[model samples]
Target chain A: MKPTNVRAKSLVPVARGGLLDRRSFILSGLAFSSSLAVSNAVASDKISTSKIDQSLPPWMKTPGNGDTEYGLPSKYENHIKRDVAEHTPETSIFSIWHTPIENQRGIITPNGLHFSVNHNGVPDIDPQKHKLMIHGLVDKPLTFDVESLLRYPMVSAINFLECAGNTAPNAVSLTPLDQTAQELFGQVSGAEWSGIPLKHILQEAGLKPTAKWVIVEGADGGSHARSIPISKLLDDAIIALYQNGERLRPSQGYPMRLFVPGWEGNANVKWLHRLEVTDKPAFTKDESGLYSDILDDGKIQRFSFHMDVKSVITRPSGKQVLPEKKGFYEISGLAWSGYGKIKQVEVSADGGKTWAIAHLDQPVLSKSLTRFYIPWQWNGNSTMLLSRATDEFGRVQPTRAHWRDKYASYSFNHYNAIQAWHISSDGVVENSYA
Target chain B: MPSRFLYPRCLKFMLSCLLLVTALGQVAAYADDATYTTDLGVALSPSEVSPYEITIFPSGKNLPEGKGSVKQGEGLYQNHCMMCHGEEGDEGPAARLKGSDGWFSFSDPLRVLRIDKYPILLISVGSLWPYATSIFDYIRRAMPHYAPKSLSNDEVYALTAYILYLNDLLAKESVLNEETILDISMPGKQRSVSAWPEIEL
Candidate 1:
């Protein structure tokens, strides 16, 4: 049996009268024998709850007072915390620590707890001194300070930005026993972003006839520049200044950033400083030799930027061990597509052999995160779990091998394969490769 | 017959001359209406027309001259890139560049959902990118982040050659300079189609 202290630390007490609390209590009591000791050392050591307090203040402590300047998730009202794992100055890439998505309820990823992927170290950019310049192939090159950008009409959308290399480790044949959901898929989260339309700025600048591409450069030390096609700029691109309905976080391109809808997160250049319209693409390292993919056919694939449709069963995923019962369990997760809105998400308990349609929460916005749920009853047998998503455009999620044949596995930008989770008889769920 | 007919013809000619003068006056007035400014001198040459300008299209045009063998690139990759990008461009805790199952579907729903099907803005050497000029320009500007823009034109070309060779796009003996680099065709070029038409508001 697991230690009593370990179990106590791992489990958060449920409100006695609440519906979920009663369910959780009943479930906990029944599964107590099989429940392993919550490894506090592993959990606490890996995740620093201190970062959570940095984003929250004292006055908002009470539930009704709503201490969050930005709101905390309702279900996880008390689990608010920053997701920083370790900070290093060298590559500027900080760990989001590791938060199990299986434990999360509802869709709004908490601001402090949102996963972070920084290329160059995060810059302490002062909004007072920050400015966005629109130059290059334009009749008039104009610069907008943060104040001026705020004056323009603002729009908001609940969207998710995921690093292209979010799940590169899952490609490894060896299952990473030490891996957490945050490490496997923590690089993604959805937030309400508010910003000005990129097209509005381009129209104001009066794009010249020769302009073919706009090169967006970040102010970070890496300067992190990439050439975005002119068409995407005019579509739904925005110069987002606010995330989760407030000023952008420092780690997430504070002051200002480019929100390239439906494209790779990196292309949505964070800490945006300059938009140079040019007659040709700016061969920035991030776009050419770096972001470009070398395919299997002895040819390099360049500028292939749109992220495809994908879905993951957040609950019953990595790290979370389930109960050894034959009763119904609520399987829920988030699904999204860069192409368009996710029309439907189907969950398959027996791998891809059979699938059952899952329910999606309403207000399905385009290029936004959509929550999905299905009540699953386990029969006390080991099973291969999978979920497939179909976007509005009729694009279905492909198998791992199908994607590998097109673009060799060398490039890590678009790895939207059907993910699988293995359920042992003991109910310990693990990351599995089928 | 003479004098009376000649008098009428002279009157018609005189009226025609007056009309021609008025037209000329209007033309002169139009020219004088426009004013010229001397504050800004002659128009500057377009940046694209500069001598150092190098741009490559998908069809391999406008490539500069220079040659870099794979053997030469191997040395440069070893000395500079081996530590971070990996010895064979596959090593790195940061992001690996080799041995990916290119189009393999990930079993993870997050991974599957995030993979782009027709990724038109690829940042790799194999897909979506239309030009090789970017390869030279990018390597010349920011690469080996520890030592930014440290490689010479030849070394950049050599590194480009080595990377292309590793991807199996370039022959081992082939030399890559500004000139020949664009000549080598990338395989995933066909996959990168034109962008979708913008919806008119």
Candidate 2:
């Protein structure tokens, strides 16, 4: 039989029946296992931190290996990696690898760990062989090789790409897994993308007045396609050539991908090879049916492109245990809005009864991640921690009760409700809706 | 359908226009360089773009010449599909693709229901998709699960017809072509609404 629970005794005990007594009954053997490690660290404070090393550290004594053509992260950082999930383990082509946001710090996610949602897996594309085609309702069809696109004047912006289907498990009525913030909300990632404006090429092709939408198709095996309004194309859209200052990663659409700032990630088509101008939205399978949100009302919300304002605390989240029963800990998390810059993010340690203003990191860029934090003091009592973010346009992240009020019987996609992580008296944190 | 204006790149024409544009700054990254080089891309004839032009829209544009019926699709389904999608496409080890039992017939998850596992919505045609073109378009792009884009145009049309027939939208004797597929009015067609249509940007 499979057992989901295992108990661990708290080394430091608080008052009786506070929360430490209940932490032993929590889900997962991982928390029980980590409690032992936490106990060990407490027993050997100075020695655990390497102050009393038996010998000189191997890396300090020996010279490091020769340089590489391309650098990789240190072996110690191997544990920090994306959590992958497929439609099924049998079919490898369709999958998504969530970024390990809990193990990460700072605003920008590294290129390697950047969250990925590949419908046809990563395609092996040769830059030399790849060419971008612009046709359909244009005055004339045009084809530009990679070299030609590189020569065009380019623009760069730091933006976050959040999948429309991101963060529903914890945000909605879906069975919340004993998961980290990375597993739940890691579908959102920020990157510095550099590329030519899409309109630059469409202008060369000469958009006909009849052109109201642009159907961007990828070169992946599925030829995954989605339709975008022509107005957004002329606004801040780009055919991205580089990601985080390097030739685009193969998984991130090697030669090029369409980048629509402040919009849903699928609309920013990756592995882009063609842009067909049309009079209306293509009603593609992904957009019309898949990405579209099903509301509580009888109507299904299609073409809901703007990602709502959302935030989540990465540390002190599910599975991670606090080392102390009573102590001061800086609560930190990432926040972003597809609508505009985050105006403010408020934190409430005691559920929603009272609130404290969290500090927003300076120079908040629109559509990019904004890290928020506040000094939190634990009082050895079980309590619920919550956070809410407001954007420049004044759209605040709604509560779980508010979110469910609007969504349907089985609505799953576009879930960005305010997260509630319950902190036990023993310092174990878990996802809590009650 | 030929357009009116044909712009050719010239250094002299660009240099003169460049001076006038410098006086007025830009809002976003883009400024209309060409009165529309400002033509770096090579112009292509219709045939050159034809090889990659398999995309089909709601308007039934770009569908290749082919025809298929439910009978042909039945044989093809057993050979290529049936394993993951199952005998009726509803008894799935994969996605449920047969039935469209109106709305809200599936299980709701997590909280109030205490769903022991992650909820996977089993969406089928007529319930999920609004346009019939999307079914044919999706199958042409991705299908048979293991080997994608390996099916013939006739096979794609056949499968499209079969799936539609299974959903009770098409008759058992129905044959689908580019024109006939567009004529299908999916039950879920008008069910979709924009959550926030006022945000025009």
* lDDT (tens digit, per residue) of candidate 1 on A146-187: 776676556777777776656656542234444556657776
For all predicted structures, in order, the TM-scores are 0.64, 0.83
Native contact fraction of candidate 2? 0.58
Q: Which of the numbered candidates is closest to the native, going by highest lDDT?
A: 2
The regions of model 2 sitting more than 4 angstroms off are A1-61, A86-93, A171-175, B1-37, B101-120, B195-201
Recovered fraction of real interface contacts per model: 0.18, 0.58
Interface RMSD of each: 11.3, 3.8
- Tens digits of per-residue lDDT, candidate 2, B50-155, equal 8887777778888888999999998898898888676776544445566542233344222222122213333455576888888898888888667789999999
What TM-score does candidate 1 reach? Answer: 0.64
Q: Compared with the true structure, what per-residue lDDT tens digits does model 1 show for residues B1-201? A: 011111333556755665787878743221211111111111223452343233333334444456678899889888877775656554343333333323332443332222332121123344444455656665555566666556677787888888788777788888887657757665444454323232110
**Candidate 2 local distance difference test against the native:** 0.76
| lDDT (C-alpha) at residue A244 in model 2 | 94
